[model samples]
Target: MKLKMHISKIKCINDLTIELPIERGLYAITGQNGSGKSTIVASASRVFFNLPMKEYFGDTVDGAMIEFELDGNKRSWHKKGKSWLQKQTGSMNIRGFYEGSLIYGYRFKDTTYEKLKKSESIDKAKLRPSHEFIRKNLGLILQGDEDYYEKLYEVPREYAKFDSSIFFYEKNGIQVSQFHMSTGENLLLSILNSLYIKNKERKNASKQCIIFLDEIELALHPSSLKRLVAFLEDMARQYDYAIYFSTHSIELISGIKPDNIFYIERYNDGTIGVNNPCYPAYATKFLYDHSGYDNVLLVEDDLAKSIVTRILRKEKLLNSRLVHVLPCGGFRNIIKLADDVTRNNLLGKRASICIIVDKDVKEQAIKYKKENGLASSCGMNFLPIESLEKYLRMSLVYNVDQKLFKRLSDYVFQQRSLQELIAEYRKLKEFDTDKNGKVLYSLLDTELRNRRTDRAELIDLIVEYLFEENKQPIQDIKKFLHKELE
Candidate 1:
């Protein structure tokens, strides 16, 4: 059975709704920090598992409602409450209604004291949140040593204990009940758990299950993340399970299929807006048409996907409408993807294509470019992940706006690491940090205030300048050759 969720009147969200595919695969929920990404997950947990809404979210006047479909029938839950005065004046009512049937309803007066008085009474609660139930069934793995190597001799119903159980590892060490493990160990354990736990469930279940992971990119090395994605995709197909994970990592976005991709954005009012890449008619067509092409633009791992798409559209070399600007987690994946494209004929006629990789990946980019025929031809363009830095060092150094370019140039010279550069940028007046803490976005008001030229036009001019002075245009070179000779 697939679960669909529609929420209304929740905290920081007025009318937020999203339908999740319960197909046995991964579902990724990603957005800027505090964009209510976690809220969606929390709300779903509350409705599905029958938990106290007040426990997760503090007091609120507006009641929340969730509607979901179960077993081909629609069901809805509504929670209404007034603020309690002195822990005695108000009540919270939970009503479950399904297909004209009033399944259940309960009212709790003075919940604060009631919760404190009977905190151990689990039976009083009508529905347990799905997350809590899963955790309980699976056994809670806390942030320490007890969680690591913790084995369950008996399997919970709807869940089976595997020889290799799900474990959480951190940078410090394996979080065994009380002891911590090394980052490498933690990463290895996470990879193992991600696959092993899912596999075990698939082996035991009569029906397929879905695995949802939040911020899956955390603590994972790029190579490991890539391997995990590939493994997850295969496992989903083999076991008839679906896997969905959210990440701020661009590398994962570009490497995966567009049909499986979903974007979450936050509105000013605190509600989240979901953009499913598969749902968009045009995007769906594009993905279906170009499933194998590897010659792709790989932008910075931390860059906002919207900005990258806008930049590509401005260049006019490729229309963002048709060409997908995939975020390949980072420079490492860019190289990996490019190499894969060249060696594998997955793209057919579109096989030999160029990828815009970061200059920071100089060694790998150059080596790959030299080794492959596709990489040799205008198929590779290495530039710094920072456009300002690239503009300052490469040709047309003076053509760019002096102040903006100089600021980035100075930053590049002063900051030795990308992390340090981003950190310093955040300290500057113009740059603002997004929820993810990884993307440092320039304030549009501040950026435009000092700029005289249209930024998009300036970018195009820069591209034109590079093409004229640095190398021949690939399109022109293609036109000069006659395919009839072949």
Candidate 2:
């Protein structure tokens, strides 16, 4: 059965207490090394591996617990000294790794997914990691659409090797070890073999699966890493599986959907785990300071960061030499992060933090500003409207990046000039008082970013277009920022 809601509470065993939405999708465990990423992995392993609580709590003094929802049932266990006190609210057919569908690990160096790297010769007694995987989930693998079968051709069995305790790739019909393959090729092969095993076993079992991995982006080229992330996300939906992986890759975190990232850290009290930290203050400051920026404006997401950065720089309200844009992920995250990063002179390079959210955030922001004295300290504001996207009020770009270039040209500016298009859209039923001041720009996100369109450049183009067209709302935005900065 798939895990629905899993919560792990711990103390002293790496000082962790975290709740994870360990459902069918990619969940990234991100932090510096030794920040308890592996501990979370171990907690998952303990639950699915049928290991004793004492195994991990061997010396854990403060007590720990694992509670999860599976197959519409709730189960939990807590460590009490060397024994586990188990409790359950419904019936469960508990199964371990051999149950056709269960949690698996690809932790590297010494992992259960592959034969030990130290094994010199193939021992028939122990199943070849891939083959053991093959025998367990062969049915499920074959059931996959053409992609399942396609994997074998891509990682042909003729080139598959286990004699040396590692999988190999076929090059010109020659079986070459993983070392011979390019890093990306090797990663792809490993993933293919693992998926193939699970697919093959899915044919006869009602078991759901979860895969735990760490530092999984190793050796992947940027393009290849992006592709792999897409593939894994898609597969999670197609099959019943959950992937929890750890990484120190900030670039990877930036590229991934913000919601998928969970930043682990050790608090001042020595407790660890980030249940749902939006901006992860420590890591944010760490990354920012390390990058050498002296002033920073923290916003909701990438889009807001881009918008705010462009306006602040254009108005010259922010010192060009020191300011940097940091997206706190969302409004909630911004609030959670504000408490820490807003402190003056934090982390040596911590910038003066300005917080922004939607119009809905005004009350909360104001309250927080007074309670924490952040208003005069740094700066805080909710936009003049509900949301930045809704505030901008561009219908075509409303869902920009949501669907790339789909019927875009057909929908926007068919025969009308820019001013005409704005007038037409403003007259539409959806254009209400809430959408005020946003009807100036054509709704389309820039069609095909020619060069680095992911930054303020895209926002710059839109603002420039409006200024040249004499759009009043564009001027209003500048005035608002000028006042906020003042």
Candidate 3:
């Protein structure tokens, strides 16, 4: 059911690889604007038809290659100049079924309905299936509204310039043409009509159907969007269909399984990256939803969060779906938050919360806990080292290989010899936390801002060194938080 795709040298997407479910499931590819979500959909759509490369990538594209696997065979589509070449399967069945499966709501603009209105020919028979589909599905979305079911009539159509002139019935059975419908209603009708029409036209030519709907949430009311999502879920299951939605709807993305959601981002290096099984909080930039997680590990900063996450992953104790490592302000705030959660049972008995701070803050955390009469079950823990920066510095001196050390020095210190830089860094007053003096963590953060080099990547190298040089400290933290696994 897993379909792996790799697209390289194409438009804004330099190189991107993603995995999608090809069998039967609803999947979403979402991200901020210009992250290549639509481009990915276009690439996948090209597999089914001979689309012009110029349509998507404009006039200039250094040769592009898109590869995917179908039935244990690797198939590729290559684009050079203005034309596309395909790895021929010799049979037209798969392509034939998929060619009619793409639906773009934007394809139906106000002008389109205007054209439909002037057409003279009427085709009541061809409109029956899609009209019935919209009536039944729309009724579900408008469940409490009597008007939707009692007054709305089956869409009637007259064959038009493009395809058909669609009409809707309102209260008193009054006829309203497609041009008169609200944008949300028009969008919904266009989507369902296209889907039903395509499926009907295919007529079970293939056992599985793949649909790519771009910007599916365009102009839909939030309530209608939710119901449409549920309706599509049912449709996906009823018929063996793999439906792909390229959208920006948080409501739509949040409801999907983490593995089925793909988050796309264009990094500073101008290459597209796709994070499959992306967390909903990450995709929407709304971190408050911890409803599905069983445990939350509160840390002082993102670096600490990365360190804890890396350790848990290294020990095989991390399941991202269940555990959330959240960076919650400073040391004082994290301690206070943990104490409050424990004393008030904020997360209830079913969820576990743990506080982890740097080793340097252990004394202060202990003092605060005693002053507030914090419970022992508050689960206070500390990193093995004084701070992540100090630990990373130590690792650079002793643990890392020449290649990695050089890379780290080049990125963080701006090509300054790390030994000299570390000596100077140690001499500064309040070097660990001073903002004016350019704290080591702040320097690393600047690298992130300037180059999009994530702190997580730096943490990966540091944790890799920790796993080899010292792993017991990580094991101890994992042991203290074992209630999460329960």
Candidate 1 structure quality by residue, lDDT tens digits, 138-179? 222223233333331212222212222223212254223101
Q: What's each prediction's TM-score?
A: 0.39, 0.56, 0.55
lDDT to native, each model: 0.44, 0.52, 0.65
Candidate 2 stretches greater than 4 Å from native:
1-19, 31-35, 51-57, 61-63, 85-192, 203-207, 217-227, 264-266, 270-285, 288-296, 302-326, 330-353, 370-377, 387-476, 480-486
Off by over 4 Å in 3: 49-53, 74-77, 90-130, 142-158, 198-205, 288-486
Question: What is the overall TM-score of model 1 with all chains considered together?
Answer: 0.39
The model with the greatest TM-score is 2
Task: Score candidate 3 by TM-score against the native.
Answer: 0.55
Worst 10 residues of 2 by lDDT: 95-104
lDDT of 3 by residue, 95-209 (tens): 3222211333224423444465553234434433335566666666645342364444443433444543364555554656556767666666666666676667555656456
**lDDT by residue for model 2 over 69-140, one digit each (tens)?**
666777777767666777888854333221111122331323433433433233323322345333222223
Q: What is the lDDT of residue 149 in candidate 3?
A: 43
- Between candidates 2 and 3, name the one with more favorable lDDT: 3
Candidate 1 deviant stretches above 4 angstroms: 45-52, 58-62, 82-178, 182-201, 268-271, 278-486
